[model samples]
Target: MKPWLVVAWKEIFESLRDRRTLLTSLIIAPLLGPVLFSGMMQFTLAKENKDHEQRVEAGVLGADHAPQLLLWLQAQGLKRVPAPATESLVTAAVRNSQPKIVLVIPADYGEQLSAGKPASVKLYVDTSDSDARRAGERLQRLLAGYAAQTAALRLMARGIDPSIIQPVVTDEIDVSTPASRAQALLGVLSYFLLLSTLVGGMYLAIDATAGERERGSLEPLLALPVSRDALVAGKLLATMVFAAASLLLTLVTFIVALRFVPLESIGMSANLGPLVALQLWLSLLPFVPLAAALLTLIASFARSFREAQSWMTGVLLIPTLPIMLAVVAGLKPTSALMAIPSLSQHFLVSRLLRDEAIPLPEMLLSVGGTLTLAALLSALVVALWRHEKLLG
Candidate 1:
């Protein structure tokens, strides 16, 4: 057997024999995001269903001025309660949360309507609630609709054409694709995926390098007839496998859960297919090697397990940098866009979400460049593996 293959097989065996660590990585694979996302989607769905069922309990002050309008409110499915007489009473009801919204008609409500002037109807709603805002908007719109209908009737009664008074009707146009719609939304998927992958590899990296050294097994393994380069190569290959496994497992769970989630019914625009998800994972492969190499080097430099785990946390935080960039920059993925590290992957996934194609040549360059960096890091690790201080 080749020396590199021999060391790689040994490390792979060592990695497997630690059943506790293997189980831990496996457990983390599906648990982290699936549980969180399911709960979040459930919560959002519950909120949407709850808000839809709300009957906008409204408080009305003036009964005499618009008895017809009060009946209109009742007809619109808004449950009306009599508002308090004074401003103080309205303020009290608002503070106590007894009324979700209140409407006040001024003393001159009839006079303004008779004079063809706009009448003031104050709507005090719980601004803290977005649902309340929508409800209030609907109430205001329904009031305007009633006014328009009444205006048409009045003009027709006066032997005037209603069409002359209302000349223009507006039709809205919205131009957004599946990808652009996803762009408009913030997917918790990206954050959780990034976090899970980084943290998932943490224990594995610690065990693969620092744990081996602390247990005094790494030196003997290094003492084997195999060259240091082969030993480093083999160990790196094993670590990469574990990282990729953790990442893949996480990806599969999330993809399955996303497919099962009722996102459209809940008023969100996200489509998570197996293909798009696989692309996302593929984009992260370079990062896995980079992460493993970084963690391994850090662990190799650290004198103790305590030091290794502590230092590796900072290693775990590096992916968050790209997350911040992707968010602030709002980058759209393109062909040459892959030249950027975190941005490239982010754009690639975002583009896929946007239902855009990942350019083949760009994908090759970015993935190739990222892998090249990982290779250089491997060489650096081999050099560190030969260092007397790291081994001793």
Candidate 2:
């Protein structure tokens, strides 16, 4: 066997024997993202379904003041609840009580309608609570619908076409495919994938460099006849292997978990079946070496295993910053942007999720850029290994 192969096998053997490393690489790191993603999706879908099916209950301050309007509201699906005695009391109740939303019909509401004037009403709601906010929005929609209906009836009474009140109307057209729509919900997937991939190699990186140094094993290993470059290559190769396994497991778990997510409820359909998963896996493969090199380099620079773990943990989140920025800016992929490491993979995975084709040039740029950076970082790790201070 080659010197690098021996070192690689040795590192792999040690990692496999380390139960904590194995657990993280095989189980925790891979499954954590998918489990959390599925839980969030399930909760969001359930809440949306509940919101659509549940009736809105509105407290009316002066139900007697607007019997006709109250009836209209009731007919439109609002269940009127007993309101507090006064508007002040209603506001106070809404601020701190059972009913989260309240409607105050002034004493002149009916008189204003009779006198052909615009009637004003107060709506008290606790906006701090999500459920209350949704309920208040629904009540606002109900009120708006009633007003429109009343306006149309009044226009008809005057022998005028109700459409005359509207000069321009809008019909929103959604051009997104089901798969593309799923990208909205799966926006954070790339972050999770990259993070998990890096995490899979984290313990091994620490073990190879900081842990070995702390155990007084690194000095003896450095004294060996093998070239420092070969040692670095062997260690990074092992890290990449574990990272790749973790990436594959994370991808598979996400695909399986999404099957139960009810994404269709939100007009989304995750295109993460076997075929797409394969495509996504390939698109993200170049990132594995880069992640391994990055993790190993960070760990190699740390003074102790605990310090390496802490530093690597914080450094892992660095790649996610680009993904977050891309999402916030609604950035579209361009050839120039493809030169970025994790950002490029994010763009590629996003395209795959949208069922779009990955341009050949962009794919080359992503792979080339990632591998180039990995090579540079690997050289740095080799140099670090060759340093006399590396024993510390």
Q: Pick by lDDT: which candidate is best?
A: 2
Q: How accurate is candidate 1 locally (lDDT)?
A: 0.72
lDDT of 1 by residue, 183-210 (tens): 4443556656656665666666777678
Candidate 1 RMSD computed on C-alpha atoms after optimal superposition onto the true structure: 3.5
lDDT of 2 at 329: 95
Angstrom error of the Cα, residue 298, model 2: value is: 0.9
- lDDT tens per residue, model 2, 1-392: 99989888999899999999999997998899999988987887788788986478878888889998888888878887767777767767888845788998889999998777799988888999889999889989888888888889899999999999889988999897877766877878988899899989888888988898899998888888878889889999999999999999999999888888998887777878899888888989999999999999999998899999889868888999888888999999898889999999999998888888888999999999999999999889988888888776
TM-score of each: 0.83, 0.94
Q: List the residue pairs that clash in candidate 2.
A: none
Residue 350 lDDT in candidate 2: 89
The superposed Cα distance between candidate 2 and the true structure at residue 191, in angstroms, equals 0.8
